[model samples]
Target: MRSASPAAPKQLSLPRLPVPELGQTLNRYLKSLEPFILEDERHGGLAFQTALNLRKKWADEFATGVGKLCQDRLLALDRASPNNWLEDNFWTNKTYFEWRVPLLVNSNWWLALGDDEHVPLRARENMTDLTPWQVRRAAWLVHRVLSFKHLMDRQELYPETTRTGISLRDSVAKMFNTARIPKPRCDIHSKPPSPTVFNAETQKIYIMVHGWCYAIPVYEPTSPPRLLDVQEIETRMRSAVVDAQKRLASGASAVQIGALTADGRDKWAENLEYLLELSPQNQKTHRTICQSLIGVSLDGPSPTFASVGQRALTSHLHAIRSTHSNIANRIFDKPFTLIVDPSTRAGVSGEHSPCDALVPSMIADWALAEGIELAQFKDKEPAPFPASPPQQENWERLDWVVDEKIKSECVDAMARAKAIIDDSDANVFWFKDYGTDWIKDALKQSPDAYIQMVLQLAYYRTSGEFTATYETALTRMFKRGRTETIRTFTTESRAWVLAMLQTRRNLLHHAIHKHSSLTREATTGRGIDRHLLGLRLMLRPLNGEEAALFDDPLFSRSQEWKLSTSALSAGSLFSGTGFGASYEDGYGINYLAAPDMIKFGIESKSACPYTSTDRLKVAIFDALAELKSLCLATDGAAISQSQRAEISSHL
Candidate 1:
């Protein structure tokens, strides 16, 4: 007999990675995209369509290739003007249609590159045309190369120098000046160079991610992120639930529940009906619905059936009665019963409370039982919850009213929407444990070297716990003469930055121990790489939409696109209120306490995370819309003279 077919390859937790391409794949896509900028078509829609197609191609073709491309491009462009692209000609020319589309597209790719160091190797074998004028320069401008070679190494292709007075850090500082932002270095006590090239080594990928963030300062761009759709939302929700469930099943406590209270059985029926339509055969629609419910419910501490009842509410009983509860029992055996089900006589158990609105610890009973009870988010300082729009949207509305509170509420909602992440050591997984074994993985082996890097500034009052600012810590660093090293940081402080890059990896680290022994910390070397994995998963639906929007020929006109609140979270692209922009702050994970951080600094990718069940989300890239106005050539309001001078000094 044919042995049971080997278990299907485990579904990848991350986004489907595109094949490796040249380091300049983005540069090439920009070249192709550049032509689309000037094609004045007889039909505006046609030009729009062409541009849309170009955007899709760029987004798809160069997405993963962007990290290294951006580092080099920023280095090269830093010479032409400032290293930062936002406050310079790149922004100025785009509005004038002087290949701004290409620059803007380049900006988009730059942000996508993030802080990874391995980017260059992911590109095609040949990385030659990186600085080709055809590919790199804006219209009406000549080419210049101001990257690392001349700055840190002091080597220019041609040597007619006005002054050779600059130091490596001086040149790096210059890149900031050229970009018209505040210079990067502060007045901490200086130390002699490491003598060795590596002063302090961090994971190459983290450094790459860090520098990319510094390049754009784009995460909290003026605008916000976007939302996802029903099916996609359902999938993400289910995945988060599975994440929580695996924890409970293995013996860990649930973090918190965060979702819109389930609609009564009516919504359940509707969702199931929709599924039935998608699968018309004498299908296991009921079983499938229950199956999905089981995944979500099991994540909590209450029996899986209870969680289901809570999410859907009163009619939850009817749905359970009609549903095949056995579907849930297979995963989590709770002696739950639906009054109407033929086999079970267990009637309504208690006054099943409405899934409480997001308040810390409110949903503890039905939500997985874990986490400390925070003060009524209301009772706490109002800082983390920014002022909602003049009008918060009714959750049922389809338009663009994404009340940011909804996200916090939703995250904390079931445990009454609170954050699932916490300060307990159990919630953390120190990277040092992984050793350097990452070198053996085929996917990681052969990473690109860095000429430039990204840095994430995490502000924490130096005490071993979370506090509002990094100012105190910086002062401490200066006092201790350790400002330059991320390594010298105390463990508590390092956890924030680690959380940013590693994201859910910590959760999984805390989790795998309870599920499969192979996944335990002892076997932690078989890793989750959570942040990347979650990003990969979050990207699928976004790419699908990008494909759709890319195909739309009438995409450019004022009427071509619609903006709404839904874009407020995870939609990769949208012209709406910034989706979760506040999340970029250094401690967005504890955002309820500190919202001002959004006004400054590199984003914290770990803040909202994939555990957020809100389908209503968007990508960090959408923030460009807000930043766009700040970028106008004539408008330097956002760029203060002091900041400009600092940027200039580096030049």
Candidate 2:
């Protein structure tokens, strides 16, 4: 009897991402090009009318010619894809895999967790020995994170929905037990055996200490396995720390194989292959890391800085790109790595290929909210021994077989990583001024759009020019959707900047409204950038037969992304979040606009003489203050004295 396999359990259904009409996308693309044409110096100087007409001609030809073919191909792809067209066809390979640079500071995103108040700053300074608080905090975090994973496994965690009750795509399945594996020309992501089930092997996590890697189980053996309690996890961690210390005291040196992960993709691929060939033990160890749930680094104390913002910056930097001394204490390929220092100062650095930072940050928000209570150990000794002696054999140290070739490669990789760390100029700026509440109530503006305007003003004031800018817009409303670009540098925005320069307030509101409209379009899957990208990828290998619109100089210039910016949720549980700049001569700005204040994480390269994080920080402050004054002055008598005084105090 053929039993029609009970119709596959009705899966949570969401609409597929729609491919915007060709004409609509083309029209939007031409409008976006206007800002670039206005500043074009090509052909000795492009006259406004002449350049606009030429661009229009190109757009007309593209809309009817090769562009139509590309659009048709894209539609065909959408029909064939099970979920999202961009994701199934070319998103990851085009956006992430083909980019061969080291992921250390260039591609990975980092988030610094809010401080654990139980462990104060003074207690962390110049700390040499491992404290009980450190182990306990690490254990508690691990337990909480595993609990989040369990909720996900059981589907007990409700699906995240939009304000209108539309379900956002689920990416949490990829956030754990995944790794981005590097290959010759393109990298691939490794998948877990079962995303919804946990076994003894799948329940393990790897820990790195003093440039050494060790694996420990996080689930107890039972008829139905249960997560190890905090005390039990702490026992295992303490045992590993003790073993690492003893090995160091006996003068045993670690090979720093993790350094290979921080090298260029091709180089790392070669080194990894060679190491595996050198010993069967290395192959087993490699599989263990790739299949483990996640990696946690028990790090040493970070160098003390002058301000809390600086301390946050240092903590995030350590998580993303470690110092040369312990550079090998990280596996940057892991989907997420939780880094905790001696004082329980914590942060997460994630590989960007498997999913966006938002996916893991959601998990972090849950884990960070439940801090270990002071009462848990108030009356106990500083260091509590495990009631039962710890099982030392359960911890397996990951050892690598290194020859001269691998050793030399490690040295080169370390040098390259160190250079990047030194060149990064990262700053965490806490804007104590008013935030979303003031923007919505007093200025009557969208907080995100207002911040975009502020960034435009800040960059123009700093560099004396406006360049191509990118703001990420999530398309999670569709099944398996990722992000679409919201091009923030528009004619309206430029006019507003000039108006501000001349103290003319007429165009400010118009510009903000335009940005808000663009943002809405992007979030709804009608953005110009992703559609254009999909069409480009659909093009067949062409020998000078491509669409004229794509070959136009403005097309390439408009996407340079000199100012790459994105805003996360209020982020009350996070100190700051950031990613590297897309261009060497530009800046990367990620911010959190809370109800009462804003926090910004800004990064630039020190080698770029025109870009300075410190200068940008100053400019942001000036722009925000100026905008606040203008808003209040424009609506005089509308702002009450108490509200004015409150805003003044925050500044």
Candidate 3:
């Protein structure tokens, strides 16, 4: 990228927002993370554990927000349509419900990303012919799945204020963080900067396109992420430098002097003003260069991303989120090899559900139906006497799992809703005083359907998030084989749509084959009870008044989340981060954090509580431990030899 400022602008300028002071410091922080990937070999297991702990921490934080909402004293009051109840872009809910999620998303994910990428993703991909809702719904799923992972438990709903005059500080911080590059040791070995053509080298550009997933806390879906996230990334980087300069100029002590060196804060200001401000220009160039490479990781079973609507759907998603999060959390073991083939390390063979963890209970049912009284030690293996037909045709051929009658019902229900959903001039339907009337009865709508409705709402809301793949709801449906799967579940418009809920149910698996193991859930019911409790807690409304909204059409159901194909991503959400940190590292943002988080591998925390100069080394050590724990565990998380073999065959 050219270093010179773009044709120096005129002196007159538009109104300028106050610069956030942590910008450069944030940029420097991101730069510090660059070394993280490079040093991964030095720290793997610990990183994985750290991720788990982090997920727990985030989950706790989310739960705390819900707890606060539950503590509110508001009662049921019917809100009418055309009232302020469902007004667009307003965060009018109580703080426990509104401020909590906003604070979380803003403080954690939004702030960090603002510091790292500097922008919040805004544009919903606009492809017209495909299922725009599915594309955008996938985005919400990404957010839900990722956020769910951070909390280990599904988070309760929280809300946020309108996007107006949003906080730019978080994004500014993220940009400063993104600009950070690795510090070089006195090098015996170093890759010299690629030679510039003579003096042309100076003009040569390098843009770094960094993508990783993090859980942001938001009470509602509005706030600092009002603009397209990429733009925010670019804008925030510049803002960070300016903020750092101002902070250094103002002499803030807590603002550490220099991340690269122990120089005075003044020196940091100088580097920031001179070196950092121009860094984004280089990054922008580098990003352009790396843009084509963004989808490379899509082919394999890897961690993916989130959607914009997650902030809006807040509590609604918590229902299925428990199971969905679990899938995201534990779905990436070596056994995941079955999701995508091993050869490409990116694409799947589509021989089974991309998430095989979904089929366990079904498999167990199949075995039992055949009168195969499975032995306690038996995995997916048959009993001493096998049934007449070892398996059904549906098992071998992915098609016809359900009868034509079931298929017709589902497809018809989905098609009817599609008619209204596809209309171009449809006004967003909502009513005021919904709390008393609609919200009062809204929960009557199936939670499963409610979950799908939320997703559908999100999809219809924006097409700027992802490219579409299907034409009609019935197109190909699920191939039961290869290619992008799409299908119309029902055209009735109200058949208790639970698009992705089935996925949640699907995630509950039984030990199949030699390598699989069964938990106590098969008989005792204790484990399933606990899981159900966790899910209930996650899905419950903040309080009785808020509960009413669950009944309202505007406040109710939508769509589901699914990766169209193996070519997009192998694993889901935190299961993938650009730096490739272990899932334990993901735990930081994956699950709800608890008091134990203080002991969570120090590196996994948003702000390491440790104040030692050796903090970096300690963090690295913790990450290594987490990775090792992953492979060595028999907790049903470790990838098994048999599972890998099975996956490789499909690949």
Each prediction's TM-score against the native?
0.15, 0.91, 0.16
| Native-to-model Cα distance after best TM-score fit, residue 377 in candidate 2, in Å | 6.8
Residue 89 of model 3, lDDT score: 12
lDDT by residue (tens digit), candidate 3, 1-651: 869768742332212111112223222222222222222323453453353344344344433554234322110110222221111112112111122111111111100000101111222233221121221222222222223222321122111121111211111111111121212211011122332322222211111111111111112223321212322222222232233234434764221111211122233233324432455543333222222101100111112222333222221122111111112211110111111111111111111111121221112112122221123112322122112222211111101122344334334423432231122110011111122222115322221222222222223222212111111111011111111112111121111112122111111111011001111111121111112122223344544323221232211111111111111111111111111011111111111111111111111222323222123323323332332242234343454676545433321
lDDT of 2 by residue, 1-651 (tens): 977766654455567899999999888988898777766643357777789899889888888888888899899999999887899888999999999999987898888887777665565665675556677778778888888877765656653333212232257777776788888999998756663575455778999988888998988776467888777777788788777877777899778777889889999989888988999989878888888888998876555422355665555555545666557888999988888877676788889988777778888888988887645443333464343435656677887878999889988999898898788888777888899999999878899999999999999999988899999998887878889999999988887786675443445677789999999999899899999998888777665558778887788999999999989889888888888999999999999999999989898999999999999999999999998888767743454566545433311
Q: Which number leads on TM-score?
A: 2
TM-score of candidate 1 on Cα atoms, chains taken together: 0.15
lDDT pick, better of 1 and 2? 2
Q: Comparing candidate 2 with candidate 3, which one achieves the higher TM-score?
A: 2
RMSD of 2: 6.0
**Candidate 1, overall lDDT?**
0.21
Compared with the true structure, what per-residue lDDT tens digits does model 1 show for residues 35-150?
22333342254564566566655455434553334334544543554322222323222222222111110111000101112112222122221111111111000001112222
- Candidate ranking under TM-score, highest first, comes to 2, 3, 1
What is the C-alpha local distance difference test score of each model? Answer: 0.21, 0.80, 0.21
